[model samples]
Target: MLYGAAYYHEYQPYERLEQDIDLMKEMNLTVVRLGESTWYSWEPEDGVFKLDWMDRVIDAMHAADIKVIFGTPTYAIPPWMAKKHPEVMAQHHSGTYVPYGYRQNMNHAHPAFRYYAERVIRKLISHYASHPAIIGYQIDNETSSGQLHNPDVFQKFLWYLKDKYKTVDNLNEVWGLTYWSHRINEWDELWKPDGNSTPGYDLDWRRFQSQLVTDLLDWEAQIVREYARPDQFITQCFVGAYSRPEANVFDISKSLDIVAINPYHVTQSGLELDPQNDTDTIGPEWMTSRQDHVGVSQIFLNGDWARGAKEQNFLITELNANSIGGSSTNYPGYEGQLRQAVYTFISKGANMVAYWHWHTLHYGFETYWGGVLGHSLEKGRIGREFEQIGAELIAHSDILTDLSTQADVGFLYHEDSKYALSYMPALSQPGTGNPDPLTYERVFDNFYRMYFNVNAQTAIVHPEQEFEKYPLLVVPALYAADDALLERLVAYAKNGGHLLLTFRSGYGDEFARARWAVAPGILRDAVGASYQEYSNLMKEVLVKGEGLDLPEGAAATAWADGLELESAEALATYQHPHFGQFPAIVTKVVGKGRVTYCGTLPNMPLGEALAAWTMNKAGIDPVIEGLPTTVRVTSTTATSGERLLFFTNWSWTPQTLPAIPGGGKDLLANVSISESDTLELGAWDVKIIVQAK
Candidate 1:
């Protein structure tokens, strides 16, 4: 496991290379990332290049035994390139080109942009290809921030559709273009996606945009592979779904060697809000706090998603080393918060954890975004804490390396479903435009959190994945799906895999058209239940049941389906005035397996109960039973075949655990512990145990 920070030598106000290297040695930082945010300095002119300064920095770091990951620096275009080729700037939906000065604002498909991008990338690779310190390359910094909505991009989309559908009639039929008088007789008749009312066209447009972004990344990775050594890897730093929704991460990740993510947790103040409360009416304090909860969960969720993307261990290219600036609320770190954060990533099978930056920039756009070292370039609270984390990581590097997580529960996540549902606003809340946007992400997290509460290990499974490895599979709000995927789910369940499906699963086909058959379309047989109508709840509905562990009168909100069971038994019924006694939850048996359908969005308590019950029925066991809600436990297998258990206290209060079943040594504390020994963890603390072989 490598420990370090992204270094920006150009951002320094003075020469501190020697001092920084000494401090890095003290902190046990074995690696440093450079050249990502230095495009303007790298190529000040169109054809002129400066490599001496960066070469010196790499040489110095190599002398100190510090490996380097060189960035291609194509994310930020230089002023000369943009000024000379104005067509490279991304044209927005409003028909205006994005202005210069911001990163990721250029049209990735623009020939001029690609030409200049290739030049800089090739130049950098040629200069640093044989450098001993250069161990890897970060292709681009956070690809697909801006979507191109210009004529050129639209033409490319038309070409993509033409290639896929082969004929204009096929394209028109698949997109249901005749609904809005949008039937395209000629390819030129298709305009930019500004006011298209056809859901199929809108969904396809979004998908095409994702493809363009993937192509851009693939192009860059191909160029880098030409010069990168066999030992050197290539990756791109990916942001979460909160930003850059146009980029299909799974597609883009296929071109890289390993997945890299920029995982930033929400502030401390943000963690205080009610997790279930919507942020629309909440005050800044509550809103930020709620986002913190989402952010923390996303770190774990995205890590799993990234791991599943390539089915390999990933890296944290950028993690919060200090508080962020701007409109975001900044909160100081509590005791053990840093330790808990670092260990959490490792527990999820991350090979390395690197902070976003080394020192806070003295003057820049992110001037207030704190770092390991503050603007004063001195050790601060976070820096000191990181030093301790660095020491521990260096001490346990061999034991932690190659460790992989083992999860018995899998949640199905489909990016196309998210995109298709995004265009169908009628499925969301009424009266509010863009109502509860990010609902898909929230629903996913809510279900995952329920499993987390009981300390069940889970993985994110894509719809295309063969998830037979997991005994229990939870498919939540898969509003759009293809027949092949539905058939696969049915076969999985028929083969003795337990399946839990929530509202909106299998409602539409891949083309975003309502299924011609009964509701839940092809999945009706697998689920043994059908629904013709579902309401977006403006008020809470009560649920009563004995099937799961849900308490009577438990609240169900946000959405509810009027369900009718065909071969399934009603597990729970709605207590609403008009919807009374209607099946809100149902279960049926298929072959040797079981399928449960949740017809409404269950509250946290009910969700937890349902998850716990389903997991038990699937014969899945938690890492440690009877643990507090404030504590989280995850287990991974070490290279030596030893079982490693990670225990973390997320709360500010200290937590204690009863004697676990395994005798092991607490690697963090360097102390042996017996099976019957009681374990105690301080606030925000973390403990790792390697079970006796």
Candidate 2:
């Protein structure tokens, strides 16, 4: 339940450290992160450390009763390091160096960069380890900026392959490199990744790159742990890892304590939900998919991803204080939107909430990136919003901090599928013929949105985690999976679990090679259906059949699997000229469980109808009946054995809810609520009820 923002005393244009601290103290700010983005300020010259400069700021934080989370400022490099060793600069996949003008452009895989990074990290942590106000250390700004393609990095990748496969023959066999005479007799004959077209090479190369990034962070955590007390934690802030191609957040979380993310999204209209407003302001860089992207759902989806990273409560390391992105995208939350976003994060599993910074930078790359205080350095709407929000959090700290979010339906987040799909996408952008590299995210988001619409509490589970406990498992874009993983999924179906799968699933093996057998290679029997051919749609196709209560416009888009029934029943089929011969959706009962397959990506209404049908068959009902589309509800089991339910209104119009099934205490009002009494949520509002066990 900690609340505050990142403080950059060094970046402040004037000497207002005392004033800023006073304002924060007055606003009930609980904690502030310090010193993560300033390497040049920490060490202006090579071997010359200005370590004492941060001491006064830490003292001020302690005096004001606000805690601190210190960060190792290694994400950015000083000018001297780049000048001293130009090789430390990261070389991109295009054989060009990432220029020194930007942050996180250094090739941490390079030994020279590691040497200086380690030195600065150790120096920064040891200098302030004994400070009473410091609670933890953020290892790096983002675990990785992007993958490095340096010559040395490439050589290490070759060694990584050798260590993994043990022989060149094994590498050629697994990757199916014999195609087009691309098979190599020796590891030395392998071509550079820039000129390579093999899917196996691309998949394995991405894995090697992820390993390098993980190793660097693990190295940083080990160094920080040397000085960190048992009470203090070590974490790294990831800015929507899905957006960062090189970052493997679930794998990276294994090295640290908590998973933290920057859940930035469009506010105002972007948060609005309606069929007409679906794709209005969805920036290409926003958190969710452009199709039916509701801002609150996008944020909660990210929180679920973070919670699943380690299957524990996560931290909101950074979120919007004002308009999040660059200048043109300036649109902060309206009225109660900011507070609604906070509760949404908590409804998932956030233990802490912190903004990017305490005050807006007057001059810098983030100058327009507003903060609690704007350019005037005075508290405004942003400050007032957090003021009430912070007070509410402090009052409910006991129950809020000790709860674990509940999950109704689970989704598999496979890194291999994400990476492989990025390299070879299955769908193309509408109206534009360009290949959509974010094909994995598009399909994944669409499915997630579907479950969210049905009020099925979402849980993002990794492949290594146990998810068979959930009643329904929806897997989207499972395009590249090995036989072992696919076999486990089939077994899940046989064990009385309801499994939902979508197009392009099981088409490629782990190495991204198309299965020599028919489509859905290892899963055809368990799935009770098989598809030999698939096509990307140039136009939408109407689907009509059982379980699909469609409107006039309910149609399938993007890609379609020409599913031929074996032992499965057709749940839905395409209404097209020749493609109608194959089913678009199929289902079959296996052993005691059932398998449902979706052969095409459906539009919003169609997708929702499909989800409603699957959940009906799976016997997974909505948490609450008669809930509004603009209102979202989630619950967490408090340590005290009480169930805490959060109700959020995502629109500008206030909404009334149906009477509670059982009476509960409204913690916000400090009053008891009766089962017969209904509650009203204001525009962009939130309400939490504590129901006794």
Choose the strongest candidate by TM-score.
2
For residues 19-51, could you state the per-residue lDDT of candidate 2 as single tens digits? Answer: 999889778899999899888888899888897
TM-score of each: 0.96, 0.97
Q: C-alpha displacement of 300 in model 2, angstroms?
A: 1.4
Residue 111 Cα positional deviation in candidate 2, in Å, after optimal superposition: 1.1
Mind sharing the TM-score for model 1?
0.96
Q: How accurate is candidate 1 locally (lDDT)?
A: 0.80
Query: What total of clashing residue pairs does each candidate reach?
Result: 2, 0
- Residue-by-residue lDDT tens digits, candidate 1, 1-693: 988999988889999999999988987888899998878888999889998989889999999999899998888888888889988888877479899988888887888988888999999998898998998999888888466797788888888888988999998888777775778889888777776778888788888888888988899999999999999999988875333688877788889999888777664533322333223322235334344236345556766776777778888888778776553545555657777778888888889888878998878688767788987898877878988998999899998887789899999888877877676743344334346555666677777777776777888877656688799999878877888888888888889999999888888888888888878888888788887887787767878774765765476767888888889988877777878747888898999898898888777677778888898889988778788767778899988989999988766667789788977999989999999998998867789989965
Q: Total clashes, candidate 2?
A: 0
Question: What does the lDDT come to for candidate 2?
Answer: 0.85
